[model samples]
Target: MDALHPHGMPKSAAETEARRLIADWAQQPDQQPVRHFPTAYRDTTPLPAYGTTPPVPQPDHRIVPAWAAGIAVASIGVGAGVTGIGCGAWLVLQGLASVTLTSVLLVTAPFAGLAMVTTAVAGAVGRIRAAVTTHVYEGPVTHHTEITNTSHQQGWFTRTRNDIS
Candidate 1:
């Protein structure tokens, strides 16, 4: 049925007329509402083949819990720091065989310095990469559009047209 014509979403008066017709249809002994929906295949087009059973519906849970993931990442960083501190302490206290404090610290000094330098280099490189770098060229350009976008309405498109056509 045409849900809308000149009118909007249907009025109660129109619905009463439809229900009257439906009641007349239901009163016919042989007719059933089953014929309203197709149940078998046909030549011109395949019928919808209505099933007795209905499909189960599922709930949507698509978004990630940002608070939970943030907590997880923070805990991982904390664990890594704790591990580094514990490892450094163990090396200093339980030195190999009979190594003196000076020799032990001396031996670990290079490794420690290298580790710290590597960590600092990694963090510096990461921050430098994240700092927003862009390149601009000074030259003539045919198109110039600077539009800001938001979610309230459909967007606009523009292009240059030649004077001839």
Candidate 2:
């Protein structure tokens, strides 16, 4: 027995009419409403995937802090000055201790004077460099950027042609 008409063709006019109404409703498109969705959500196509994941972006790591640079410059300047002064003094004292006054004056004075002059020049240069040196930053920097990249994939044997009149 057909499940849709268990009792055979409708025996009453009302049953015949009811069956016709259901058939008509089924034929109408309104009976099954078409779902509406935004374009972004409506796509059902699967994206092509490679075995490897996209590379993770690496942040730049070579920056040196300004405070460290300043400290380094200051230390170098101080060391150069101290070395210059100390060596000059030691040379003069050694000459005075070992030699007669006239000999010490003749043999060591010029050498000591040269040493002190060289040291003075180095210190002055260091002081000028420190005063002129510019620092990159006092703190870490945070940067933001927006990028839009578009690429077209072309097949082998494809050619672009231009026509001119």
Which candidate should be chosen as best, given lDDT against the real structure? 2
Instruction: Score every model by TM-score.
Output: 0.24, 0.25
For model 1, residues 1-165, the per-residue Cα lDDT tens digits are: 545534674566578878999898878968645547657743565446785544446899887799989999999999999999999988866766567789879889999999999999999999998887768889886764555444433358555433321
Q: Write the per-residue lDDT of candidate 2 for residues 1-165, one digit (tens) a residue.
A: 333445565446558789898898888956676789767534455555957554446899887899999999999999999999999999988876887778758988899999999999999999999999987768787765645454444875555454332
**Model 2 misplaced regions, further than 4 Å:** 1-60, 99-165
CA lDDT of every candidate: 0.76, 0.77
Model 2, TM vs. native: 0.25
Please report, as a residue range, the 10-residue window in candidate 1 with the lowest summed lDDT.
Answer: 156-165
